[model samples]
Target chain A: MSCWDTIADYGLRSLGIGERLLPRDNFTLCQQVTLIGSGMIWNVYFGTLAMVSGFFLATAVALGKAAQSPLLRKPSEWFIFVFRGSPLFIQFFFAYFLFLSLKQTHPIFEPFTAAWLGALIVLFLNTAAYSGEIFYGALQSIPKGDLEAADAYGFTGWNKFRRITWPTMLRLAWPAYTNEAIFLFHATALVFFSGFPAWQQRGDALYYASYFADKTFNPFIPYPILAGYFILLTLTVTGLFGLVNRRLNRHLPQQSRSKLRLRPNLLR
Target chain B: MLCYLTTGKHMAIYVSVLVVLVLLAITAVTALIFGFGGAMAARSRFLPLSWFGKGYIAIVRGVPDIAFFLFFVLALDIGFEMLRHGIKCPDWTAPIWQGNDFVVCPEAKLPLGNAPQWVHETYAFFLAVLTFSIVFGAFAANVLYGAMRAVPRAQLETAEAYGMTHRQTFWRVLVPQMWVYALPGLSNLWMVLIKATPLLFLLGIEDIVYWARELGGSKTPRFTDYPHGDWRMWYFLALLVFYLAFTRVSEIALDRIMRRLTHGQATLAGEAQRKAAT
Candidate 1:
C-alpha cells in the first residue's frame, strides 16, 4: 500500500475506526507516525475533557479547602491529600478495580469500567486534587491587604470571594496551575498503561507508540514521535494557560504581573 | 510465610513495600549524584558542558516522564545486550535486528538465558533504578542549579578575597550554602519520588500494584484456597493506606530534617528558626 493508503488504514486506528489489526511485519516509518498520531486523538480527548471539567471542580475544592468550617474543610483536605499523596499510577489501578467491582453490582457502572470513562474519572479527580492544592496555596498566600481592601469596599461573603478573592487567587496560582495542566496532559498517557483496559485495542499515544516499538524491536522511532506529540500538546497547553494568565493579570501593572513559567520540577 | 501474618500471604506484601523503600532510597541518592553532576556541568564555564547540562535539565520540561520510563527501560536493555553481543559474540554474522526480533547472542542476554531466576529479577530491578535515577535526576538538576545560583555571589567573592581557589570556594562556600535553598525543592522532589515508585510496575517489576492486581483478580476453584471474586478494590485500598501512611510519616520526617538543615543557615527559614529559638 502507498503511504496514503497506509495512513487511511491506520490513521484512525487508535479510535478503533479505520483499522482492525495493526501492521504485523515490515512496519514502515509512515505507519508508525500515522498510527501514533491517531493515538494522540485519545490523549487530546482525555486531557481536554479531564482538564476542562477538573478546572471547575478544582476551584470548588480549593474553596472548600480554604473554608473556615471543619465540616467543609476536613473532607476537602482529605480529598486533596488522598489523591495528591498517592501515585497517579496507583490511583488508576485502584479506580479501575473499583469501577469493575461496582459494575458487578450495578449495570450503571458498566460504562465506568471502560478506559474512556473510568480513566477519565481518575484523571479528573487526580488533577482536581493537584490543582486544588495549587489553588489553595494561592488562596492562602493572597495578600491580607487584598481581603482588607475588599472588606473596605463592603464586599462580603460570596460577593467578596467572587469579585476579589477568586481573581487574585487565580492570578497568583496561574503559573503553578499551568504547570499542573501540562502535567495532567502528560498524565493522560498513564490511563492506557494502567489497569483500565484499552477495549478494542483503542489506546492512547503511548499505547500505539509501544505497539510500534514492540513490532519493530526499535524503541528509538515511535517513542520520539510520542514525545513530539506531547511536546506540541505541552506547548499548546502552556500557550492557552499563558493567555488566560495574561488576562487574569491584565489589570495589574506590567512589572507586577507574574510571568507564567513552565517549571520542570512541578511534575507531580 | 509467617502463619499469623495473614490468611493469604504477607511476605510478598512486605517484600513489595521493601522494594518500594529500597527503590526510593537508591533513586534519591543516585539522582542527587546525577543532579549534582548536571548542575555543576550546567554552571561550568565551558560552553559545551553547559549546553549538555542545560539540555539534560530541559529534557523533562516538555515530555511526560512515563514516556521516559517506558522508552528507556527497553532502550537501555537493548543497549546493554547490543554491547555484550558485539564483544562476546564478535564472530557471529547474523544481524541483531533480524526482521522484527532482537536476536542477541545467548551469552549476551542480560542475566544470561541460563542464569538463575533471581539474577533476572535483580537485573530488571537494577535497570528500573537506573531509569528512575536518570529521569528524576533531571528534575533534581533543575532544583540544584537554581539553588546554586541562589547562593549569593557575594559569598563566592568573599571566599575569593580570602585567597581561596575556585575549587575551594565551590566545595567549601557554595555547596554548603546551596542546601538551604535546595532543601524545599529537594523535599518536594522526595515526595514526587515516593509517588513515582509505583511506576516500577510498568517496567515489568512485580511491585505492590502488580501484587494488588494479581492477588485481587478472580480465582477459580482449580486455584488453591482463598478464592475470591475481584477483591482488587480491597487490595488496592490496602495499598492506598500503605502509601498514605508512608507519605504522612515521610512528611513529618522531612519537616524535621528541614528544621535540622535550616537551623543556622542564612535564609528565611533560618531567620525564622533563630527568632523562634530566642
Candidate 2:
C-alpha cells in the first residue's frame, strides 16, 4: 500500500478510529511513523488535560502549603511530600490497582480502570505535587516589598492575593513551572508501561514505537521517530508556555523579567 | 504470609531489593564520573568536543527518559553483538538483518550461547547499569557544568596569581569549590535516580517491580502453599511506601550533608552558619 493509504488507515487509529487491527507484518517506515504519531494523540490528551486540571490543584496546594493554619498546611505538606517522594511509575501502578479494587466495590468506578481516566488522574496528582512545591517556593520568595506595596494600596485578603500576591507568585514560578509542564508531557510516556492497560490495541507513542521495534527488530527507525515527534512536542509545549510566561512577566522590565531557563528540576 | 514470603521466588524478590540498591550505588558513582568528564569536555577550548558535550546534555531536555531507557537497552545489546560478530565470525555474513532477525554467529551472542544462566544475568545487569549511567550522566553533566561556572571567578584568578597551572587550578581550587554549588543539583539528581530504579523491570532485570507483580498475582492452591486473591494493590502499596521512606531518609541525609558542605563556604547557608556561631 502507498504511504497515503497507510496514513488514512492508521492516522487516528489510537483513538479507535479508521483502523481496527494494527499492522501485523511487513511494517513499513510510513506505517511506523503514522502509528506512533497517532499514538501521540493520547500523549497530548493526557498531558493537556492533566496540566489544565493540575494547575488549579497546584495553586490550591501552594496556597494551602503557605497557610498559617496547621489544618490546611499539614495536609498540603504531606501531600506534596508523598507525591514528590514516590516514583510516578509506582503511583500509576498503585492507582491502577486501587481503582481495580474500587471497581469491585462499586460499578461506578469501572471507567477508572481504563487508561484515559486512570492515568490522567495519576498524572494530574503527580504534576500537582511537584508544581505545588515549585509554587510554594516561589510564593515564599515573592518580594517583601511587593506585599508591603499591596498593603499600602489597601488591598487585603482576596484582593491582595489576586492583585499582588498571586501574580507575583506565578511570575516567579512560571519559569520553573514551564519546566514542570515539559516534564509532565515527557512523563505521559509511562502510562501504558504501568499497571493501566491500554484498552484494545490503542496505546501511546512509546507503545507503538516499541511495537514497531519489536516487529522490525530495528530500534534505529522507530525510536528516533518517536524522539523526533517528542522533540516537536517539547518545542510545542515550550512555545505555548513561552507565551504564557511572557504575559506573566509583561509588567516587569525586559532586563528584570525571568526567562524560561530549561534548567531547574525536570524528569521526576 | 510467612509461607509464601519465604518461598524461593519470593526470596529472590528480597534479593532483588539488594539488586536495586546495587544498581543505584553503581549508577550514581558512574554517572558522576561521566558527568565530570562531560562537563570538562564542554568547557574545553576545542569546538567539536564542546559541541559534543553540549549535545549530550541537551539531548535529555526534549525526550522522555523512558524512551532513552528503551532505546539504549536494545541498541546497546545490538551494538555489543555486532562488535562481537565483527571479531568472532568475520566469514559468516548472511546479512544480520534478515527480515527482523539479528543473526550473528553463536559466538557473537553475549555471554555466548552455551553460557550459564548467571553469566547471562550478569551481562544483562551490566547492560542495564550502563544504560542508566549514560542517560543520567547527561543530567549530571548539565548540573556539574553550571556548578563549575558558578564558582567565584576571583578564586580561579587567585590560583593563577599564585602561579598554578590550569590543571592544578582546576583540580585544587575549582573542583573543591564547585561541590558546594553542585550539591543542591546533585542531591536533586540523586532523588531522581532513586525514583528511576523501577524502570529496571522494563530492562528485564527482575527487579522489585518484577517480583511485586510475580508474587502479587493470584495463585491457585496447586501452585503453592498460599493462594490469595489479587494482592497486587497491597504489593504496590508496600513498594510505594518503601520508595517514600527511602526518599525521605535521603532528603534528611542530603540536607545534613548540605549544611556540613556549606559550613565554611561563601553561600547564604554559610553566612547564616557564621552568624549563628557568632
Best by TM-score: 2
Worst 10 residues of 2 chain A by lDDT: A259-268
**Candidate 1, overall lDDT?**
0.89
lDDT of 1 at B165: 97
Error of 2 at A192 (Å): 0.4
Worst 10 residues of 1 chain B by lDDT: B1-10
Candidate 1 local lDDT, B1-278, one digit each (tens): 24434754557877888998999989999999999999999999999999999999998778888889989999999999999999999999988888878898899989888889999999999999999999999999999999999998888999999999999999999999998789889989998898888889989998888887777778776865655577889888888888888888999998998889989988787899899989
Per-residue accuracy of model 2 over B1-278 as CA lDDT, tens digit each: 67767888888888999999999999999999999998999998899999999988887778899999999999999999999999998899588988877788898989888899999899999999999999999989999999999999999999999999999999999999999999999999999999999999888898999889888888889977788888989999999999999999999999999999999999898999999999
Local error of candidate 1 at residue B130 (angstroms): 0.8
Candidate 2 lDDT over residue span A221-245, tens digit each:
9999999999899889889989999
**Residue pairs with backbone atoms closer than 3 Å in model 2 (clashes):** none
Q: Who wins the DockQ comparison? A: 1
Q: Write the per-residue lDDT of candidate 1 for residues A1-268, one digit (tens) a residue.
A: 7999988998898888887988888888898889889989999999999999998999999999998999999999999999988888888888888888888879899899898888999999989999999999999999999999999999999999899999999999999888888888888888888888888888888998988887877899999998899888888888888889889988989899899876783445
